[model samples]
Target: MLLGYRASEQYNSYYKPVYYRLAESGGQERLRELLSQTPSIQIYDTIESQLSELAKINNPQRQLTPEEYKVEVARYLDGKDPDEYGVWVYYPWSQKLVHLLDEEEFVQVRTSRNLYKIKPEELETLKTKKLGIIGLSVGQSIAMTIATERICGELYLADFDTVELCNMNRLSNCNVYNLGASKAVITAQKIAELDPFLKVTCFTDGITADNIDTFLGTGSSQLNILIEECDSIDVKILSRVKARAKGIPVVMDTNDRGMLDVERFDLEPERPLFHGNLNEEGIDLTKLKDLTSQEKLPMLDAMVNLSALSDRMKYSLSEMGKTINTWPQLASSVVLGGAMVTDTCRRILLSETTSSGRYYIDFKELIK
Candidate 1:
């Protein structure tokens, strides 16, 4: 009976098009209001509407199945010459759609614009570039950001850590079922599900000095950018050195007290500050790696006597009981850092003049 009533209501709704049309016409404004009241609904409707429009345009003849619609969308967006092969549709904001060379361009237009504010030419550039990300915790956020841009042709993910229950707060790919799974694998799976053509290489062992060469030196042409979100200072320094050697820029993100710090190490052989001035005499990287978590805490505490480093340790020890676990710090740092990194990457890829030096964002300032 409920089904019959629903059917009848639908029929009546079709007949009374004016009311439905009026409601639908004002839906965008109502959606803005609903977003404030119920955020999830806004997210759902926004993604659904855009995807639905994408489906309609891709399959105007209404012959393609839902799965086919997704495939067609991916193909259209990722294709080399989207305008030449497919129909070009104009979005509301920009005047960039010149031709429908292929399916990939459609995907590029849909995902990039939805995820970030990127110009048309910049979107095109993203399709041809490659990115390497070390550390999958915050790296997952970076991947999601890059995937949304649809700019990168391939993504190299390196992480040794597996997902834990505590990681759900920050790592997008980590969940109940995925606990104990290697972060790189889970992140690669997520990216594959989003866009099957997104070429991904996962290294479950994490990036190390020995294996770093193989990971980055795939001989598949030049890498456009490298993102370092690894926990080890040694790995971070090594990555910068390798990028500098290869003439590729490196971007790193850090978070402190809800504020983000972005550092861009552009390709320069004579870069002044190599690794943010570490007191090499106090701590040996090899010895530090072998120390237990508890032992490592005091060692780290003693190694870097800087007030900022000590303050961070004090806050962490007070909250987590001095094991020096990296999860909380990583979680807080990675997301905000990923956003800043993504924005910086966009600006760089677009050939826009962006501040390449260190940048800091204090959320408290915004509250003031």
Candidate 2:
């Protein structure tokens, strides 16, 4: 999986980063062996730069010269083995070795500006919460945004599909190079590159009745908030049902007209799925799994409020199998939806927002 030289994936090693602590026994030797074996390894060590920034943060009044900054970095290490100063992260897929400050310092320097906006206490508390995101087209953006913000300590990603050329139109984390990789794997790798400390669990097979219980969690392993963005009609209804039963909040983004829907199943256990969009008589949610994509169009329309769709979206929907192969999704809408959903989730997780209803951030309407 490392660029051109493919190693037999007996251990699925490409998706994870291997950490090397030179001070530990055999760590230095192992790292050296890895470097020697990989002919096209890319080395990236910015520990000195990070140390300089750390010094500035610690002593804002002092402006150190070049030589003084060097001294400051050495002083910071303070006799600690320079090789063991920070973590050496080896990303298998890209065959890149990255040097980063350990978790505490890395987070401090990485999220220093967010201190007041997120609040030091809130950021710490947010690390204890667990969130799950289903689907990866728009969910990829949501996951990347959440990871970049360090909004959750643990994240669960479920996507049954692989990256395709068409997905790159909206999936920012994917590219032509990794066209056949699992969406969940691609997202997880991206998150790892951002913050190796954050725990991520991937359901590459996507969620089904079999793994639903485990994904949503049971007892102490439950998710604090659930974000559903899958294209499956059955999953949309089924996940809500499960989340409602567990009193977990569910948030979603339609990537159309900036629609963000929140269902606080935790607040109201009796809340109807999709805000009662599927509650009408003769529409059986249980049978949705048995229907084809074309057959499920009516339910999809009702759930998304066909009448309220933007004129362009409505027309696009009408041309799903005619003029267009599927619903059109631009990169702009997907990115905006990611931000909208992340903000809503942060607010909900921090007890800053509790209302459950559909909200629109339609730029055309707002700007006018």
Candidate 3:
């Protein structure tokens, strides 16, 4: 499920020239770091091949057997505890071994693209922040993308549903084995597999009115950013209410035409909820509970924008349970949504950009 490795930071200069000189000086240590990735030399096909690679580090010259090779390799590990071999990390749908880089090295290797956009000097700021993601549908991808890039040092995940056969359409990492497993458990496990260093707190009970305050951080610590993807309408509005009071930003992806909603409660304490789209359409938010499939259509359209909604979505709503049992969701749209929201969260968190109101990430608009 995950590939684990030990990592250490090998560079720290603010400038490239000085950093390169420092990295060059620690060249042998870097090589040892790279070689320490595998379980042991036994995993190698032949002892000669293992020693051949390690021999490059030998100052003079010496012959050694498979047994002696282990001792020689340990010398360059720089007193790293022999007890820990590698740290396991799971990145979304697939898994693989990557260098166990130090905090700086990991941040550098993982988020190079985030540089310039997120100034190198400002990288550590992201790690100091905490982000919370609720609902595992699109939120799972958002969580993974955040972890894959080491966006935040600590994360809080909340999801109550379980992986069902129907969920496979969008929840890609979950397979039969994960069926019946709570979404929060699944997401937390996935996050653990990806980067053990990332601190995660799971709310398996889901975010409810009762616990929303704690979720928002009742203690001294408050969430820096909140990504809400819950299905309960009450929780949706209530969460925003709490977020506004706490001055935390909220982001949500609808997975339709790249539709995303940004509520900058942190910036505007009195901002209207969901841009007041529901009220504008004469839609009653209080009547959302227990509505029939067809009855819910109008509210959905208003929440996501009616006129701009895709023809396919309009048709799906018209049919309700007739043609499709539920709203159609393609994996492409979900993943695109995950990436969009995560990128937006990154820009907003880093102060590199600001987002609010409603925006369409429709590919149709981008290409033509």
* Strongest candidate by TM-score: 2
Give the range where candidate 1 is weakest over 10 consecutive residues by summed lDDT: 12-21
lDDT of each: 0.58, 0.87, 0.68
Candidate 2, lDDT over the whole model: 0.87
Off by over 4 Å in 3: 1-76, 79-117, 280-299
Per-candidate TM-score against the hidden true structure: 0.63, 0.92, 0.71
lDDT of 3 by residue, 233-264 (tens): 65676678789889999999988899999999
- TM-score, cand. 3: 0.71
Segments of candidate 1 deviating more than 4 angstroms: 1-109, 112-116, 218-220, 258-267, 273-276, 279-314, 317-324, 330-333
Preferred candidate (TM-score higher): 2 or 3: 2
| Per-residue lDDT of model 2, residues 11-32, tens digit only | 2335677899887899889999
Candidate that would win on lDDT: 2
Query: CA shift at 192, candidate 3, in angstroms?
Result: 1.0
Error of 1 at 264 (Å): 4.9
Root-mean-square deviation (CA) per prediction: 15.2, 2.8, 11.5
